[model samples]
Target: MQFIGPDLKGASPMNPTYIEQLFVKYAKINTRSDPARSATPTTPGQTELAQLIATDLKTLGMSDVQLNPANGYVTARLPSNTARKVSAIGFIAHLDTADFNAENIQPIVHPNYDGQDIRLPGATISVAQFPIFKTLKGQRLITSDGTTLLGVDDKAGIAEIMGAMQYLLAHPEIQHGDVAIGFGPDEEIGKGAKQFDAEQFHTAFAYTLDNGRPGDIEFETFNAAQATITIDGTAVHPGNAYHTLVNAIGIAQQLLNHFPENDVPEQSQNHEGFFLINQISGTVAHAEIDVIIRDFDDAKFEQRKQWLIETIATMNQQLDQPRIQYTLHDQYHNIGTAIATIPEIRELPLKVYRDMGLTPNIVPFRGGTDGNFITQKGIPTPNLFNGGGNYHGPYEFITVEEMVTAAEVVARMIIAHGA
Candidate 1:
């Protein structure tokens, strides 16, 4: 794959041109993190890209360039010049894209979009499918040609942090405390922060530039868990299988029937929780089931997991084989509890954005973030938007205007936190 040259001729750290260049730079790289691999980064592309970012930080005069050998985690330090000592703050972003396809991501620049349906070179992006396009008139936007994912879920975040750092280095007169930068791999597979060196890359608080839409400041995310079930049966000749043979497929269907139809992903929204049956495979002799459970409330999430366990026992008795085995695994939790204790960290960014004439939209994340894990690890971390929508799919997009605003917002947050 050829690298697309980012045109940064007219771009500044706080303008659409500069942010667009950064997005273009990050988007052109194919760094998909793999879930099945045992290696730290999981993908070779992620390690390559982490080195690229580390080089950039060194060129920008950031000190303490340390790249982790285990997971390809990258970290840098920017010392503060403020007279009064302030708490060190961290800004984090992921280096890898989703496990989706990333062959040739052709990004289309809508230079001053009229808020209508946009037709890419191919049928990759369309306004009719994404109604949110109506709200972005007169704003320059970037979209993939629909062949691959845009990678804005966290790449846009990486750009925001980089652009803000460039701005701060250019203007050192700005009073601020120490700033820490971290980029991790395998976030898409829920393992990005597993090998993160929190003690080495120390900071009092942190914020993940990984979310959807602009003005979105999130401190709460869904509690997540995965469940797997296996069923066994005996196969017999069809001619004599009337009563002796047990169809494991039928038993799998019985488990699905046990779940409430209304509690699925398609029908639920807001605080409504769901039990999603993601994968299934079965035959007369063997069968396997995989399910994902999500909810904002801890009690509801636990209940959802318990329901799956009870369903397996009930089905085993109905089949009279008792050959069903189940396994449950927890993924992550909501950061609301962590943020509630450190109200200053939650309110600081919102106050900074509002002071800049921007309306801070407080939203609950229906998904988990690296911040969820960092918060529980003793760092006050929250999730912030990078001005992108419809992530992890070919329809993903990022507004040039929103990316620039995000840079400004981040710079402002650092300044306020130092004070």
Candidate 2:
């Protein structure tokens, strides 16, 4: 099981070092996505990582290796050695980290971790705060040095997919159909697979390695939409301000006050939906409020959008002018609606997990993933775990053994498909 890499002297695909090295190397690269930018990747660091992954894919003897700068997607293909006409399978992970502190990430590896409080420079992962650490006892855990995020949200996923591919390449006797790999950028900002060429991806179906914990297989996600409300105001001299002047900033605050504070991200969990005002900025002359709405049920999602429109109309009527201009558009729909027709896509992972002696935990993904967009484009893509905990922040951590297990599960899926 511990076969050394031909190029990476001491690295073995089965050994946790192989995936840990890749994770540590990738986590150091600051690929944090910016939502304010309108470009495909929204940042240059993503392109840098994409290029690095492309070179690594070629080094792994993968074919059709391509790094599309226009979209910031790095993809490659591993041809099948079997004669059976099995449909090609795809595995996807994002290149960019979340919008947290991603600069100067110092990944610290704790080998043979005992159940103890891990102290970082600015943050601490206390056993009391995260009881799950007790379960990960005796495993090698990787975390940030506390000045920045660990970037294991999707970097772990990338390393797991790469490890699985390397394992199959080293063991040619394990039969599998064509395996396609895609590393997308800006998934943190929900634009990772927006420009993904599914036809060119050449896969009948896919799975996004972008969730938390092992044995998690999620197909249900929130129906999402984004709304931008622009408020215009009249500016006048102080002498005439009493009757002629209007403050857009004040109106923006008033509009926000109308939204129920209890119906926000912090107050809602599980299947409950919420309307969150993520960003708001402006002066007296012009103001803008950027909000996001999420709900799992189609009826509730539509009602939320309708409520926003009605709130804007009510504000305009009170102001006696069209000062508040707004636009609400669908970002992505729930993937469960599309995947419901294809039972095999969901059942495959369950069967794989059972065969691997792992309990399959079918949970509703509280947020969205690349699978949401790709599944809408004719692929029944679900989400698998990246074997991490406390994602998207400084307290994020993952065990080397968990990542190795993820790679083994991925390899098992491919082998099962070829059967």
TM-scores across all candidates? 0.90, 0.88
lDDT of 2 by residue, 1-419 (tens): 12233432322246567888889999999999999999878988888888888888899888999988778899999999899999999999999988799989999999889989998887889999999998988989989998899998899999999999988887887778899999999888877788888999988899999957888889899999999999999978868898788999999999999998899999998889999999999988999999999999999999999999999998899995889998889999899988888777887788878876789888889888999889888887889999978988999999998998899778878888887
What overall lDDT goes with each candidate model? 0.81, 0.88
Please give the clash total of every predicted structure, in order.
Answer: 1, 0
lDDT of 1 by residue, 135-228 (tens): 8888888888877888897889888888888778877777788999899998888787867778887898899999667778887888989888
Name model 2 segments beyond 4 Å from true. 1-13, 36-42, 121-123, 234-254, 281-286
State the lDDT at 369 in candidate 2.
Answer: 91
Off by over 4 Å in 1: 1-17, 114-117, 317-321
Candidate 2 lands at a TM-score of: 0.88
The TM-score that candidate 1 achieves is: 0.90
